[model samples]
Target: MDGTRDPLARDERAELHWLRAENTLLRVQLDILTDIATGYAHDVDTILRLRADR
Candidate 1:
């Protein structure tokens, strides 16, 4: 019996694996962006408070 059984089935499985890996990478990047945005927001708030005090 052939290992592939069906060539399309093998290809589909490979594609799905690649997509899952890509999705994981995107999620990690999005989390990093969110963190950066939150940091910037905090910095802006601090600056605003200092300006208001003057």
Candidate 2:
């Protein structure tokens, strides 16, 4: 109900946005791993040979 509270609200929104992005990335990673685990040799090989920049 004051200007002081605005900064905290902004920080919370930024954190929530970051968390959502991370969650989406993790879900995709899990899906890829699941595919590889389910006998997808191409996916397995691709993962094995991947040179992740980060």
Candidate 3:
């Protein structure tokens, strides 16, 4: 076994963990934005429908 290979393996594992954390954070942010957009659309639709009824 090569002694120098252990550090590379450790670095890869660390990088993988960081990438996963970043992905999770980005996904949560995306969900929040989606929720905001959906709410806005609902509000707009409501306003439009109310105006149409008048």
Candidate 4:
């Protein structure tokens, strides 16, 4: 039997929307972590340099 004319059913559309939102949230979180790690590395380097010079 032929299925409904719509290529994407309602439930499929909702799931896709939810997945896209989740992906966006994760992307933002990863960006924040990257920035924090970068800052921490810079601070560690500065501390090491100061100790070595003294």
Q: Name the lDDT value of residue 23 in candidate 1.
A: 100
lDDT (CA) for every model shown? 0.94, 0.82, 0.94, 0.96
Compose the digit string of candidate 3's lDDT tens values, residues 1-54: 665654458889899999999999999999999999999999999999999999
lDDT of 1 by residue, 1-54 (tens): 756665468889899999999999999999999999999999999999999999
Native-referenced Cα lDDT, model 1: 0.94
Worst 10 residues of 1 by lDDT: 1-10
Candidate 1 global TM-score: 0.82
Candidate rank order under TM-score: 4, 1, 3, 2
Q: What would the TM-score be for candidate 3 when compared with the true structure?
A: 0.77
Alpha carbon lDDT of residue 25, candidate 4? 100
Task: Summarize candidate 2's per-residue lDDT along 1-54 as a digit string, tens digits.
Answer: 555644458889899999999999999999999887777777776787785533
lDDT of 4 by residue, 1-54 (tens): 577586788999999999999999999999999999999999999999999999
Tell me the lDDT of model 4 at 24: 100
In candidate 3, which residue ranges exceed 4 Å CA deviation?
Answer: 1-8
lDDT-superior candidate, 1 or 2:
1
In order of lDDT, best first, we have 4, 1, 3, 2
Worst 10 residues of 4 by lDDT: 1-10
Q: Give candidate 2's error at residue 16 in angstroms.
A: 0.2
Clashing pairs for model 1 are none
